[model samples]
Target: MLCAVVLNAAQAASAQSVVVQPAVQVRSVTTNNVSFAEAEVARSDSVLIVTPRLDVLTVNPGYRLNASLAADAVTYLGRSQADRLLPRAQADLTAQLVERWLFVDGRLSADTTAGNPFGVLEDESSTIFNRTTVYRQRISPYVERELSPRERLQLRTDHSWFQNRNAGGTDTRIDTYLLSQRASYELRPQPLGLRAEYTRDSSDYSNLPDSSVLFETARLSAMYEAAPQLVLTLTAGSDHARYSGIDQRETLRGFGLRWEPSERTSVGALVEKRFFGTGWAVNLAHRAPFLVLNADMQRRSTTYAAQVAALPAGGDVAQLLDSLLSTRITNPVERATAVQQLIAQRGLPATLASALDLFSPSAQLLNSASLSAALLGVRHTITLRGFYDRTEDLIGVNPPPLFSSNARQYGASLGMTRRLQPDATADFSLTRSRVVGFGTNAGVVTNNLSVRFGASRQLSLRTTVSAALRRQWVDSTAVTNANQTALSFGLLHRF
Candidate 1:
């Protein structure tokens, strides 16, 4: 019970739903099946928390092979028509070394989403939002050792290489150069915890149009349950990120609190504040069996940067800069010049220039604010439900924007669910999205409609279908939005 509270607090602390990495400001999970990032967010990305057993395989004293396939269309955004798919068919080999002191095991997996970078692989895969296909030609290997029942250590690794991608687009083609390590420890006698991780992502971009950004990361966190109804947590971390041949450092310092009043009632708040000249935000949330509510108000300010060969590179690092930016090497100094020329030759886009212009001193409020509320109920007989939330986001130019130039987002959503049996259910929902801002795409309207059917019992099969349409009141060179619709079918088995 205490462990549950601590986990909830951790999610409340890391609620942005976005992490800026060297490769990209990843909004969703990529290759790692285990969603460390999403776990920090407010919700569980996994559709099925437990997979039911169909049959069991036991070889001699310490070996087993279990098989099953499952899929579901998992979406973070209520309006996103693009959902993920995961059809997992796997087997395992286990061996016992000592009574309970130590043992090692490995597994191999095959998935439908192994190629086609933009392909949808899982109907309920956690990486659905990324829209990237991850595949392997042969068997994948994993090793596990038991340190104790409550606390354990693990070392797992995998390698991949992608092929044949359209160059007119972005990051494609993978290289077998990335390696990662993870370790987790459970605090004794109480629900407390600590974790550390490091990784090197060096995928090649030869098949794509963008440069491959290598990501190196280090992180640590501590958490504790302060009371039966509340939990507190602290996190500190740093990332040395390199992108487009340029290096930048990202630091983190955050804290959070969560309060659960009863089995059916809970409230949460989080503060993610950074030391850099960046920005910070606080999130508040409340939930119940039949109702859930959320509100987010955040502000971020950025500096407008300019580069000139005439500007002094003066500093103790000048010697190092000279060596790093040699003609033979693709370095920051040289790349800065090329980017400067590009901005000068074409003249930077007005919209972007205006966004960067926020850095200038302004008397307006630098804080963005909004409110959201949603309600849902089910009679348990027919399985009926509905929900809605509204928020006003002023994100354009610092806070208070131009007063007249502010970006306001208004969203309204309604949904319902029904049960066909004790094991099968169906859901249907419709959503409307509107945005008012300074850009040409401002004052836009988007509508999303969807339906889903699921089975949670034996011979599991789940599927969902949805579509989205976006319309802009004013014409713009950028995409107004794309019309998307997808369907999925999946099965899961366990032993």
Candidate 2:
């Protein structure tokens, strides 16, 4: 979700059960340069960061609740401007109000980050150039009712807001809301079904009101299962959008297929005719005991507000929920066996990694594709990923006609994790990316390499000492080359 995959064996080893818990971490970090710049502009600093985290889980017969909360207090030596206190929290709830009749699901989250790169908030690190503070919050709720044994109805609503203030005293804000309803019915005894959905979306911008938009869409779909492993679908829809008092409408038709010949392999594709042009989407995935691969491509029209709201934060919340659910097995041996059963039973691909790119605050037609693969072994792991994206009808500073331009981006990363001993582990990764803007903006290429060595040992029954070293590099158009080195030591106590 953060444009990168972080495989932590340590987390996997500790994810045995879900229970209410509180953890405290006190860390001290020393860095040679925190500005992510060359020696001429770099500044050295020492910071003490303390994080208090809490995990709450309540699982009952008819409802489940999961929540996480953390607060970071950062103190910088020599009175630097980068010192601040930050709080982040996320919560998810699912409840069955009436047995087999009514259901409710909801999610709420709030976080702060450094900047918005691809309409998503990018995490803060030593290599980040901009220090802008962006805060985001989102709330989504869904309700479902069983109309009959073979019929169902659902309603969903989402609200999100984002506010950011740059170092240069510039502030921006965006608000978005969406409401949708879906109905599904089984058409026959066989594997045939019909579904209809209607949605309305509205977005508002404090700085760019002209860029705000209101859109509505209605879709009808039919699906037939030809075999246990294959299914076919057809969809017809209409979309209407209004921007700055201008209305545009389009008719959409699409056909799709889903094929999974084996438990470890899957392929899906959809081709559609729309107002902008012909659009297509494809997905392919395969998984094995030691390897996993996923790839996808899509073309569509979207707004910046929608993209931002859809983007994930630092981690994959859905995957985290899955992991938490999987931890219900309290016995160690049973938990291990359950993991194997899950691996064998899983039929869907994992979430794809995020791509590094910039997003504009305007309605645009976009084409994007990505591929990610990973190999896991008893003691080592390897990962590779790449992506490409292009956009048209980009909004510009001048009014009237917007700029029609495209950007190309591609990147790959290789990483390996090894265990030195029972209590020590080390890993290293290298990533390279190139972004070229065709019509506007300067082209930039970036290379980043990082290595971390972590050692943890128990000091007592409930205390541990952990130390790590992280080194990173960055090359960008704004800054030719820069390097950062950091050493961190932490003490953790669990209760």
For model 2, give the 10-residue run with minimal summed lDDT: 1-10
Off by over 4 Å in 1: 1-178, 185-210, 217-225, 229-231, 235-238, 249-252, 257-428, 431-495
Clash number for every model? 14, 0
lDDT per model vs. reference? 0.33, 0.57
Give the alpha carbon lDDT tens digit for every residue of 249-347 in model 1.
Answer: 778667766677774445665554432234445555444433344445554421111100011111112221223234333543343343322221221
User: For every candidate structure, what is the RMSD over all alpha carbons to the true structure, in angstroms?
Assistant: 21.4, 8.0
Task: Quote the positional error of residue 3 for candidate 2 in Å.
Answer: 38
